[model samples]
Target: MAISTVEATGARVAVVTGGSGGIGSRTAVRLAEDGLAVVVGYTANRDAADAVVTEITANGGAAVAVRVDVADEQAVAAVFDTAEDRFGGVDVVVHAAARMRLSPLADLDLAVLDDMHRTNIRGTFVVARQAARRLRDGGAVITFSSSVVGLAFPEYGAYSASKGAVEALTLILARELRGRNITVNAVAPGPTATELFLQGKDAGTIARLADQPPLRRLGTPADVAEVVAFLAGPGHWINGQVVRANGGIV
Candidate 1:
């Protein structure tokens, strides 16, 4: 069955990649609350993505779940197509889908590096290209990066490198958009309490990393979502910049 959160009422639309994941799920809900119709893009776990859509609908917000492979240009394009076909047009894009494999540069498996680049780096570019071409005037494009890019933490090289490319793309794309009135920016988050981050680490390690932030606590998905909401809505002047959403971790 096709589910929709709220009736489309000519509201702005947002396509959020990785909408089944931690921060991405929260971001989809937040944008819906902000009066934008949302298309939640997920690679796997249709049930998880459906749950997010269900929550948004239950809250009287507008949302739909779509399957997308971030690395697949056609799939990503179809996500945007669904948004436009279901709603009106896309005004905001949050490319938060990514793959994180922690390893030092030396011992990292070559296949692992290939997978990371295909999804993280190449996927970001593919999505960004589509957003740049299709986003309406006064739209916003937000990409995800990690605070580890600045922390230079061990075992984060491959992931950080992919995000670094995202940061660079954010800047140049903003300039390239020139008179389009679109804002392109990257959000670099610090250590957040997401399942992706908590999976393999011991409790002690997680606690230690959380305490590194001056706030002395890990960031919640909601915390990051707020920043995304800002960039997508009122943060119009913040183009071509990376807003570090980490709580003083870097």
Candidate 2:
């Protein structure tokens, strides 16, 4: 079910891509708590996405789960359509949908590289395009990048390259949308203790990376979500920049 725009007339609306994932889900909830109706967009995990929506609605917030493939223009368009149709107009778009594959560039399978780029690079562009077209005045577009793009960790060639493209486009889009009152930015997180980051990582590897940060711990999904919340809400002056939400690992 959709949240009628009339019921949420003054409330801002948000569309969070990959809302089933750790950071994405937290962002959806955070935005709801900040008084925005949200559209939780997921690729295949409808159950997970629905759970996010249920959590928000159970708390008396308005939210709906939308199924979308970020790389598919039509699917991404539908996500924006849902947000506008349900909650009036979209004011914030968090393009947190991405894929990460680790392999030395020389050893990486061409197909693996292709898959990562398709989702991380092309997918971001598809989402950005729609947000630019549909977002109401003073809206925000937040894309996901990786701190690894700067750290240059081994076996992160494909993933970092894709995020590099995201950062590159973020600045360009911000300029393209000049005078439109929309802020475009990218959030790059480092050493987060999320299911996605923990996968296939041994405890030793995790601990070592965690300690590298000045805070001496891995960043939590909530940590990154707060940054997203800022950009989506009050951080109006922060535009066309990449905010590193990595606990000062850089």
Candidate 3:
């Protein structure tokens, strides 16, 4: 279920990949609050995606839920294509889609590593390429990384590597898009209280994890989404940078 409303201010459209889950959904809603029509792209969980759209619409925001696999080039292209066809042109792209794997290097599953690479690294490039092709002048693109890249924690080696690649890609993409008046940046979140972070952890473990941060608590989806909202809206000078939203954990 996709919902779009007329905007008196002539709303710019944004495409948020992975707009069904915690951080993604929050970012989508926040962008809508910033007065942009949002295309909520999801891989699966169409119901969840549509629910996000419903909530945004109920609040008088414009949004649409579209199914897309970011790792697939054609699907990524189609996401932007549909957004453009529906809302004139896309002006912002926040890439919050990624997969995670937990294992020490010596015991790392090769298939898991490969999947992480495909989804995190290659998927970012695919979506960025589509954004480059479709996003209007003076637009913005925000990509996701993790604070694990800085902390180098055990069992996060492969994930860190994938995000490291993302950092590099974001920098270069920003440079490449300089002439186009588009800003490319990344946001690296740390230990957010989401389904992805809570998976397989006991209450004690989760408490310990939360306590490790200087703020004495894990980051929330809204925390990261606020930063994403800044980058997508008023953060024009913050290009080619990775803003870490980890509560000084790393």
Whole-model lDDT per candidate: 0.90, 0.89, 0.89
**TM match of model 1 to true structure:** 0.97
Candidate 2 per-residue lDDT, tens place, 1-250, comes to 3332224667899999989879999999999999999999998888888888888888878888888889999988988888787778899999999888788878999998998899999999999999888888888999999999999999998899999999999999999999988998999999898888898899899889989999999999999999999999955698999998888887
Tell me the number of clashing residue pairs for each predicted model: 0, 0, 0
Give the TM-score comparing model 2 with the true structure, all chains together. Answer: 0.96
User: 237 in model 3: Cα distance from truth in Å?
Assistant: 1.2
Per-residue CA lDDT of model 3 for 1-250, tens digit only, reads 4655644246888999989998999999999898888999998899899899888888888888899889999988888877877787899999999998889899998998998899899999999998888789989999998889998988889999999999999999999887888889999998899998898889998998899889999999999999998988854688899999998886
lDDT of 1 by residue, 1-250 (tens): 2468477888989999999989999999999899889999988889999999998898888888999888888988888888888898899999999889998788999999999889999999999989988899999999999898899999999989999999998899999999988989999999998988788899899999989999999999999999999999954588899999899986
Off by more than 4 A, model 3: 1-9
RMSD to the true structure for each prediction, in A, is 1.2, 1.8, 1.5
Using TM-score as the yardstick, the better of models 1 and 2 is 1
Worst 10 residues of 3 by lDDT: 1-10
Q: Each model's TM-score?
A: 0.97, 0.96, 0.96
**Worst ten in a row by lDDT for model 1:** 1-10
The C-alpha stretches of model 2 lying farther than 4 A from their native spots are 1-7
Any residue pairs clashing in model 2, and if so which? none
